[model samples]
Target: MRDLDETDVEILSLLATDARRPFSEIGERVGLSGPAVSDRVTRLEETGVIEGFTVDVDRTKLRGGVPVMVDVDLAVDAGADSDSEPLEAARERLRDANPVEHVFITAEGDLRFYARVEGRTVREWLSGTFEGVPVDDWTVTLVDEVEWTPSIDGVEFALTCAECSNTVDSEGETARIDGEVYHFCCSSCLSRFRDRYQRLEEGA
Candidate 1:
């Protein structure tokens, strides 16, 4: 994929703030015609860059409930490694757990599964769902608050030039690793970065 231009980055920034913003409104802000903006938006959607529009439903407002975060540590099969299929199976098991809203596999220590549970009392839901499960360990963190930002920490953004420190446009074709975002000036820089990282890993 080719790198994104300034206009594309602007469009992404606008969308990142409000996914449901209309093409006409976005076009007005970005100095593009409505149809032109729509075409770009359609292309982004088709290419999977814009996954889907979603609403952040306030679960707490429903029946006066509170949201809870559950950390589930799975006891993998004796032969199973971190990325083993059995780990996947264990994650699939949580699909039926009514309290689970989202699950993530963390690269952190032994803590494998992170589940977001929405219920009146997070502790009660976790106790009921985890009953009889052979969990290695678990931790619960109450989500005190959350804030959405245009850019994330640790995700590498492409540099404008190898010599310049300016951020490269990140409308599309940018790869995100861990939390760091990287933007390549060209294929050569991308190759160079990968080669250096590979050597570092080998040495380690």
Candidate 2:
């Protein structure tokens, strides 16, 4: 695995500020050639450092509604063997529901989501949306405005091992199996993953 360097972080910062910035411009700032910058960017994509380029759209201007934030407390299912699956299912349902832009799970196992309410009060929207959902209680806040800024300052990049979920350091290795790249903290993990994958393929 390639260790993330200062140049990579600079390239990421540039891209985060403006995804449309030319590779040549980034190369100039990072003291690398255009092709070198392109190569590094491609490697970053392959290593999952760069997921994808996307635009930050102002949803309020596009939709006819009042933007609001909702915090939902979920009921724990005592009868269920595992609560994670149910929580995930509830989150998916909320995501698929209308006008929800961003969804997050808090450290205390509460759900917070941003949405735009149209033609209805916050109470009505909440009552209608959380009809069959496993919810205990909820609170809503009207959003007046929003400002989002993404930065890479003081960020540390560490890839996780595919087999053991350990952090991949300088001593780690990367493997490309069946056209998909995988990272490992050590050669033993890589070998074990390969063996298990081969066995699964043979069984299939």
Candidate 3:
């Protein structure tokens, strides 16, 4: 993989602010030619640093309801009943629930969802959504406004080894095998991964 530098970081920050910002404008700000900025962006995309650009739509204007953030704690005996849906299955169902703009899973395994809901029917919506989900308790908060600002300030970027999930650093290695790129923290892990992959392929 290509090593990221200060210029790359600045490019990312600029793009994060406005994905449609022209390359010439970005070049003027970053002291590079437009083609140089485009090349760097293409490389960033190839290295997976830049996922696809997205559009930010104001759902509140379209949905015409009060926006709310709901956090749900899973019950200890969640999905214990034989006839009840499994915990993951129930979570998947909630994720696919209508009108939910965003869903997040906290480190502690709690579920949080953002949606626009009718103020009076908030309770009804909660009960209906969590009826099949194994929820212990939940809290709903009214969101007055939403602001999204992505920055690379004070951030260190590193890729994880495809085999052992370790951070790849300057001393690490990257290989292209089977027409795809993979990173490794050490050569031994890379060899092991390749051998296991070969064995699996032969067995198949």
Give lDDT tens digits, candidate 1, residues 21-87.
8889989977899899989877766655566674232324322234445566666657545544545
**C-alpha lDDT values of all predictions:** 0.54, 0.69, 0.67
Q: Which candidate is the best by lDDT?
A: 2
Comparing 1 with 3 on lDDT, the higher-scoring candidate is 3
> Mind sharing the TM-score for model 1?
0.34
Expressed as tens digits, the lDDT of each residue in 1-204 for candidate 2 is 566665765576567557899999989977899999999988877766676674232223222367778887777888988767657867767655645656888887667988767736778877777778777888788887765432368675667889868666543446667767787654556767989999999999
Expressed as tens digits, the lDDT of each residue in 1-204 for candidate 3 is: 655665765566567557999999989977899999999988877766676774232223222357789887666663455523434755666555544656777776667877767777988988887786667778999987775432378575667789768666533445566766677654455666889989998999
By how many angstroms RMSD does model 3 differ from the true structure? Answer: 14.4
The runs of at least 3 residues in candidate 3 whose Cα sits more than 4 Å from the true structure, single-residue gaps closed, are: 1-63, 78-87, 150-204
Flag regions of model 1 displaced more than 4 Å.
1-61, 76-86, 108-121, 148-204
Q: Against the true structure, candidate 3 has what lDDT?
A: 0.67
Clashing pairs in 3: none
Model 3 weakest 10-residue run by lDDT: 55-64
* Residue 188 displacement (Å), model 3: 54
Consecutive 10-residue window with the lowest summed lDDT within model 2:
55-64
Error of 3 at 135 (Å): 1.6
